[model samples]
Target: MSGAVWDAGRCWRCEADDVPVIWLGPVQTQEHGAGPFAACEPCIRRLEQLVETHHMQADRSA
Candidate 1:
C-alpha cells in the first residue's frame, strides 16, 4: 500500500491516532508501492527490544 494508505489510520500496534513517532521499518512490500508500517513509540521500542532479545537468545542457543 502507499504511504498515505498505510498511515491513514491509528497505529497498527497501539491503535493510537497521534502523529507518528516511528515505524516498523518496512516489514511488508506492497505490490503497487512501498511503505513501512507505522507504529507508536512504545510499540516500536517494544518490538525492537523483542527482536534484540530473540537474537540474543538465538545466539546463546547456537
Candidate 2:
C-alpha cells in the first residue's frame, strides 16, 4: 500500500491526466504489457474499497 506522491500524471484506471496522482505499483495490461501504475486519489480510494470488499467476501466464504 506504499505509494509515492506525484504532482501530475495520468491515472491508469480512469485515464485522467494533469492531476495529482499516487504511484502505487506495477500492473499488467494486454495492450501495454507491464509497467508502473499511477492513480488519482479517487481511483485509489475506489480500488482500496474494492479490495477490501473482495477480501471481506472471501473471508465470509471461508
On lDDT, the leading prediction is 2
Candidate No. with top TM-score: 2
- For model 1 the local lDDT of residue 21 reads 49
lDDT of 1 at 48: 79
**Against the true structure, what is every candidate's RMSD?**
7.1, 2.2
Candidate 2 segments exceeding 4 Å error? 1-4
Candidate 1: Cα lDDT at 44:
69
Report the CA-based lDDT of candidate 1 relative to the real structure: 0.66
As a TM-score, model 1 comes out at: 0.57
lDDT computed for candidate 2: 0.86
In order of appearance, the predictions have TM-scores of: 0.57, 0.78
Q: Which ten residues in a row have the lowest lDDT in candidate 2?
A: 1-10
Please provide, for model 1 over 1-62, each residue's C-alpha lDDT reduced to its tens digit, 9 standing for 90 to 100. Answer: 13522344457677788655455556555575666568766676798799999999999999
